[model samples]
Target: MVTKTEETQLDRLENQVDNGGGGAWEYLCLIRKLKVRRSEKVLKHGLSILNDPKKRSSLGSEEWTLYEQVAIAAMDCQSLDVSKDCIRVLQKRFPESKRVGRLEAMLLEAKGSWAEAEKAYSSLLEDNPLDQVVLKRKVAIAKAQGDISGAIDCLNKYLETFMADHDAWRDLAEIYVSLQMYKQAAFCYEELILSQPTVPLYHLAYADVLYTLGGLENLQAAKKYYASTIDLTEGKNTRALLGICLCSSAIGQLAKGRIKDDKESSELQPLAVAALEKDYKQRAPEKLSLLTTALKSLKVSS
Candidate 1:
């Protein structure tokens, strides 16, 4: 007697558990389940597979990888006993593996053994000074322990070695922004823009940082980057269009205070105003308030 809503929910859960049918897909399902905090479902599906004698014996080398994934998910779910059992299986299978050793350190961190986790990470680094995984894990531990500066330092050191790691650069930039270190975050975005100029996100991000760290020069640069964003997105980027208007206003105000006859602002301000007004009129009637405000701020009467 399941209601339609209940049946739909069950179907979705089944789809997530099935997750497109493969070992790799199963791993992804476990990770996806962990992301949504569906720990009980993860335990139910994962243990059903691992507990079957035939399946457990047949997993072969993949057993260790499965155990590690399940162990981490179990730890997150507070199923410490299940996690411990999975970790023991992994430890027994790969006694000398540094990869398993990192998992051990992760378990310690999960158990709230911060000092021991740090020690284990340090010991691993001593064994091989260039282990990127261990370095990242140590940084994560530092962040979890509220050592913001320590985490930043560790990330900087890691980036020195892995300069082209875009994910690491993005993480570092976010950390810097959280600390209000706009210049450093801007540098990270600059590198991203240099590597992938066609990425509109990087251009927009760099423009935002420059606008936040305002000066005449920075505002001008922000305007240029915002223009690039608009062009890259085929002029459909409302935010970038607004950014152009705002930067033009800021520059005009600065010029009014310093130079009585500012040639650049005079040249750019009319063009910016015309573009914004045209877009504002073409947009949906419901969305005109924001564009109106931007136009008013720039003193563009329309």
Candidate 2:
């Protein structure tokens, strides 16, 4: 039971669709808003119109556009069954559609049908080997299913296919860290740095992975990366600063027995102090709190 205003908006939206002015984004926004307003009747009406191939062909540039609109609307409405049906229909109708298989897999994932989702994604990959989004999703699904090796395999496939993707390298490195494959994670980070030398966060991520791996010999390399991060970012980034402090503190703890009161070992303290001061003045309480904890640890350990 939509209010008059909601009904009027839906009418206007339908007019826009007829006029070829409303796109998938518009339809999705309207559907989401209508759902939030509890205007199920209006949504159902819109979905019916969108699903009507004759009406959809008369209104849109292509029938597949209408299918996408209905599928997205059904997903938004939490109508997983309808969403799956729409995707299946699209898969049959538009076998060559680039997004059909991916959408089907996503629908299956939404329904918590992991095995079916995996099959759908794998089938999609077989059809289109270069679909990076599907590959990334497969990695995430593998990780969620506690199949670390599968995740690694997907990541390796992605790397082999798209060697220059620094972001993918970062993601793969994070996955390696999760699997406690620190050495492999470090190598991934190194590749990421080579691809994107100016990104301080990469260096930080690399250092963090090394810190967790716990061999004192890795400290020098980790500190070098952290130092490069601080230098590249000119000490302005909070994440970079925090990484430097943490790496420095970890290295200091490991070296405490060998070098007492090393000035360079204490360098991280003042940088962390400066970072905290800036965060406090900027009212970034979350960063301030994190830095404060790291600073405290360094103080205790030093």
Candidate 3:
């Protein structure tokens, strides 16, 4: 989701300070800004700064932020001892902090101490029932424990309070999909589309789920969503083009002599075929013939 300029900046981040230079704060901040996860590098560069008393002292109050980043990175890298040390520093400095309590709970989660983690999260929630992180952690615990139903319940409860949470909606949708609950999954995707109408991911997901539902109306709706995805992506998305072909073909066969709208679909199918063929030719010339053979087999009428 970064611009080309931001991508260049990301590529340059590793070379910022000899891989252990004085640019640790800038490097970490840039990674945060980009929302990238270079956990091992984060832990390495973070500790390089933290280990040097002079550099660590230079950060003033920002040192605590680095500690939090390093703690999370340590957990990601499976360096539990490093994570513990960082968390200990934070906990000692701010003993009754809810954020620190979350870090402690996350540590327990990493250690597979589910009951303890749950208890910790539960206690944190007692103070602020709508703690979004803690509530999501409960869902994560359910997922980690392979309790799909429990995860669904926790996500549903979370949604009741935080309906605007796109990630939570997405998580719930995926879990439903895994369980072969396409109808329920479709509902989640609809909410996502409603919340972020311009996001092609939600459109694409909604299309796929609708297609899977396998009805004339659903296929038609799926086709419209697929078309929206293509439009939103400016036709650069190969998957959306492929979805168009699949939906058009399905709709054609199912409506062969049954529907009066065959003429409208007939025009759309050829356009989809042309788009797909052009896409394959430009990106994978050798695959063009293979794609052609496959499209011919679909027999999208007209």
> Each prediction's TM-score against the native?
0.72, 0.61, 0.90
CA-only RMSD, every prediction: 7.2, 9.4, 2.6
Q: Who is ahead in lDDT, 1 or 2?
A: 1
Candidate 2: regions farther than 4 A off: 1-82, 85-95, 121-141, 257-269, 281-297, 300-302
Clash pairs detected, candidate 1: none
What TM-score does model 3 achieve against the real structure?
0.90
In order, candidate lDDTs are 0.78, 0.71, 0.89
Candidate 3 segments exceeding 4 Å error: 1-27, 262-265
Tell me how far the alpha carbon of residue 219 in candidate 3 is from the true structure, in angstroms, after superposition: 0.7
lDDT at position 268, candidate 3: 72
Give one clash count per candidate, in the order shown.
0, 0, 0
lDDT of 3 by residue, 157-262 (tens): 8899999999899999999999999999999999999998989989999999999999889999999999899889888888888888999888878888687775
Best by lDDT: 3
| Rank order (by lDDT, best first) | 3, 1, 2
* lDDT tens readout by residue for model 1, 1-302: 23346556555656756674435335435355444445566676678778887877787776666677778778778788898898888888779888888878888998899999989999999999999889888889889999999999999999999998776788888889899999999999998888778988789989999999999899989988988998788777777877887887887787665756357545655666666667877766666777677588576444
Best prediction by TM-score: 3
- Give the range of the ten consecutive residues with the poorest summed lDDT in model 3: 16-25
lDDT of 1: 0.78
